[model samples]
Target: MAVPHLVQAVAETRGLGTDAARYWLELLALTAPDDRLIRELNGWTGKDIDAAATELQQRGLVIEARRRGATRTRFLPGGWMEVSGPDRPMDVWKAPHHLLWEDDRVHGMIPGCPQVVPPAELYLDVWERIRGGDEPGYTELRTTPHRRKRR
Candidate 1:
């Protein structure tokens, strides 16, 4: 079955809304290279994206990676900082939410990051862009390729 159909089927079997299931699938897609369908599905405003990301965070499925220059900080649920400090100048809480996932790793809160590209593909895009003397800055791509706990 196609991805959408498969997701819908499994969701129905589990008594879950297909839309929610599809949305999470779309979120997972955001971590890899982009496709036309993924782009169309992700056309929501930043606010909508943030709301969905918040939902994922609440589910404990992903964590946020806040970056500034050469420094990066990861935040877990409940606004807990991976590194402790009251004087950390970055107001990550107020930043826009974006997620990047590749393989088993999920990264969140990358500002200005676009939706989905596989880590290897994204790295290649970045490399090619740099080779052409262009800043990669989340260049879009096409075609490609999550966690949880039991109850």
Candidate 2:
């Protein structure tokens, strides 16, 4: 279970329900994979930020890395992924369009958002990348253990 920075933050600062926190974690992972997660820090005050982050690490929802004089961290979603649908690595579906539709699952606000990774690509891409997040986004894996495309 990897701990995304935002998930760790919400859990610590807002006491975000685990389910909601998980939802948002997946959301951000797909929507803003490269974006730094300090928004979680910004949403807090005083030492609550550090407190929440520490608790998140304790819960195994996040991990921290230290190098030189700098430190970094992020979230992990394997627990949720293991129990999710289709019994495979699922991709993040992005749709920032009121034209698309929103629910507990997928939605978005970026129309003609070709600038985005084409959310449709995530689910198609995840099965390969989920095992080892060694690549940039979830779609860069070409050596999937279960190499079967959906029909």
Candidate 3:
């Protein structure tokens, strides 16, 4: 299944949530780092944050926002920052592996995937339907009602 619009975009930043998606886009579009303080987006991290950042920088979707610590300066992909500030958004798309890294589930299963596959060996889907809080009636995929008992 196709990844949801937000999910695909979120993978550009961090997790598969709208906030995560917007964070990276905001950082890319922001002229100054201070702009992020309001939402406290300046301080955020996760196990995958570094990996995501590295991938984005390599793809040119992001640049070093700073020069200290893990923060370096970011610039458009393939553009020499020494000569010009940055390149247009279009240029980054031409770079190698320009697209964001999407997990197989997102690329293969559902958009903005939540990784709820559990164990593939067991009947996980059946359990999901039973646990989704929706009362499961004795019915088939069409959800046909069970036979009624005579009064």
Candidate 4:
């Protein structure tokens, strides 16, 4: 099957309900981030959060966001920051990965980790940590040995 068709098939098999799909699509269209999106996905699908994220990554739909300037790597997704535009003064938390369906496929390697969670989930987790007065850091991408060998 073609890439597009394969993506669609995977989406269908995963069955992101109308509501969840709408929410995800809206966020992607707006280029905005929502803390509740991943939580809602978990509730809707009853799949482990990490598992859902892994599935998405395996499909080449999303990539882990790299932090701008951090020495030590941490797995906090909320720490991933991007400047929206030159005019924007404050950094906004955005989804780490772009919507792959729009571009057909992602270029370059997709980062993998032992405990991968969707950006929204990671963002929320980091947010909570910060609220609790914890420092947010970078997360090192650890690809499997086979993947590393491919590089």
Clashes of each: 7, 13, 6, 3
Cand. 2 Cα-lDDT: 0.37
lDDT of 3 by residue, 1-151 (tens): 1124533544543443443344444333322223223135434544334554566556445554433221234433333211111211222211222222332111312222123333221123322332464321223457668998999
What residue pairs are clashing in model 4? 73-138, 74-138, 74-139
lDDT of 1: 0.37
lDDT string for model 2 (1-151, tens) is 1245544554455466543454334433443322243435334343544564555556555444422212233334221121122122212232231122333332333331232344334423332343344322334447748767989
Candidate 2, residue 120: Cα displacement in angstroms equals 15
- Deviation in angstroms for 126 in model 2? 11
For model 2 the TM-score comes to 0.28
The alpha-carbon deviation from the true structure for residue 77 of candidate 4, after best TM-score superposition, in angstroms, is 16
Residue ranges of candidate 4 with Cα displaced over 4 Å: 1-10, 13-27, 34-37, 40-47, 68-81, 84-151
Candidate 4 local accuracy as lDDT? 0.34
Alpha-carbon local distance difference test for all models? 0.37, 0.37, 0.34, 0.34
